[model samples]
Target: MNNMIELKNIIKIYNSKKKIKVLNRLSFSFKAGKIYSLVGPSGSGKSTLLNLLSLIDIPTSGNLRISNRNIDFNSKSDNDKIRAKKIGIIYQDNNLLPDFTAMENVYLARLSIEENKKKAMEDAKKLINNLGLSNRSNHLSSELSGGEMQRVSIARALINSPDIILADEPTGSLDTTNAKEVFKILLRLKNKNRLIIFATHNRYFANMADCKIELNSGKIKRATNARIK
Candidate 1:
């Protein structure tokens, strides 16, 4: 598989009361066709790293390349286009608009790529039905249960058929049963053209990944099944 994401000497610092280094010379290359579980303690810069991968944030210093194109962080419009076409992000909160129906929430993402409303709705319904949410398609997000809401979130994430999936604590809010079910759906999403990375504290979920990446004191520490350089 080709390298989907590449980082060189990546460093991130946050300044408020003082200068805090979150990622110190973190360098890693993530390839396509793999599921990587990001495991780290709280405040270990897991979200910071995800933000970089998703093109939502830039590093203080270093290089980032995605999908074979070198990223120019200063080009906000170009980066936004890359994110819309290549990256799919899943948040812990499911981030759905409360007033929109589940179908609307999913189809809205499709508009970022195309202007055809009818085609977007058809594609959205197919994705939702595939996710076992057809019955809840018309239900308002506020009326859906936590698990159902998360499923809708997944459908939205897949709407663009993104090449990279960045999930931040994807199942953190659900009970064990729901978390497991949701994760199963997430794992089933992997394909040769996609690179899936999810951050989680759950050891069980972490172990299921093809590779385990532990962030310790702002560095990428590889554990079991990791063959990346």
Candidate 2:
């Protein structure tokens, strides 16, 4: 299998008045083209792990390589470039710009990676349509329903054609039907040559992943293949 991400002896620490260890020498390798679900109770370091993977937060100690290149977290520009072009991140909260229209939000992601505005708009239009937001493209994020907003978020994430997608509770805010719709789009997006890492508390949704790893006390219990249909 082709490796998309490699984490070796990773450690994360939160320090203010005291030091709190989150990840304790965690080691794992993730390959492309399969959906990976990270399951854990609240504060089990699932968010911390996803933050590190998404390059938004740096690991206190460890080596992180993406697409075979080691990342230097200290360089903001370098990280930004890699993140915009190589990775797509979906937050639990739809982090859409409330003032921007759905099309604008999706187009912004494409523009961040590509220089040509016309090309980006064309691509964004297709993605918005595919995500079932074509009719709402001109509407501001605040005007859309919860599910519509989430789909727009997904379209924005995919606009850059990222090799790795890091989704944190992607369906946490949607209704049951909407959640299922979102998951279906995600599963269809998964290929044998890309990586999809999602963190969720929903067992039913987690069971749909190719591999499920439950996190507890900064460590993974075990990783197993899913048997659910």
Candidate 3:
């Protein structure tokens, strides 16, 4: 199996006024072709762990390897390049450019790695169309509804054809119908060569994953496979 990401004795501490330990020596290996659900309560550091995986935040002490390559947090430029090329992230809050149209928001992500605007827009259009946003692609981000914005955010994240996808409460704010819609799209994204890790509080969604990883008190409380028959 392909080990997409490996964490060794990882720890995260925030030193503001008081030292708050978020992750306590986390060590785990995530393989490609599987979906993992990170289930934890509020302030359990689910976002913190996802941030570390995406290279947006570095751990206090530990070794992180992605696709067999060691992560060098000191190399900001290189890290940015790696993130642009390999990792896709879907935030709970759709972080789109308020002034840009839905299509523009999606295509701009491609401009980071290449200078081909034509191909970028074409790819973005295809993604948006695939997500059933062909009629709304030209609409400004501010004009879209919660579900539309979430779909656009997903299109942007997949623009790079990333090896790993990290989603933080992808459907948390949507209604039941929209949540199911967004979640169905998310489940369809799984492939043999891609690793998907999502954080969720909903038990129904958590159980849908291949494995459920529970976090408590700054450490992994339990990890159980759902398909262990």
Clashing pairs for predicted structure model 2, backbone only: 33-191, 33-194
Off by over 4 Å in 1: 226-229
Candidate 3 residue lDDT tens string, 1-229: 4999999999999999999999999999999999999999999999999999999999999999999999998998999999999999999889989899999999999999999999999999999999999999999999999999999999999999998999999998999999999988998999999999999998988888899999998889999884333
Residue-level lDDT of model 1, residues 161-193, one tens digit each, is: 999999999999999999999999999999998
- Tell me the TM-score of each prediction against the true structure: 0.97, 0.97, 0.98
In candidate 2, residue 215 scores what lDDT?
88
Cα-based lDDT for every prediction: 0.93, 0.90, 0.94
lDDT of 1 at 212: 90
- In angstroms, give how far residue 125 of model 1 lies from its true place: 0.2
| Residue runs of model 2 more than 4 Å from their true location after superposition | none
Give the candidates in order of lDDT, highest first.
Answer: 3, 1, 2
TM-score top scorer = 3
Please write out the lDDT profile of model 2 over residues 82-156, one tens digit for every residue: 999988888878999999999999998887767899988999999999988889999999999988988999899
TM-score of 3: 0.98
Best model number under lDDT: 3
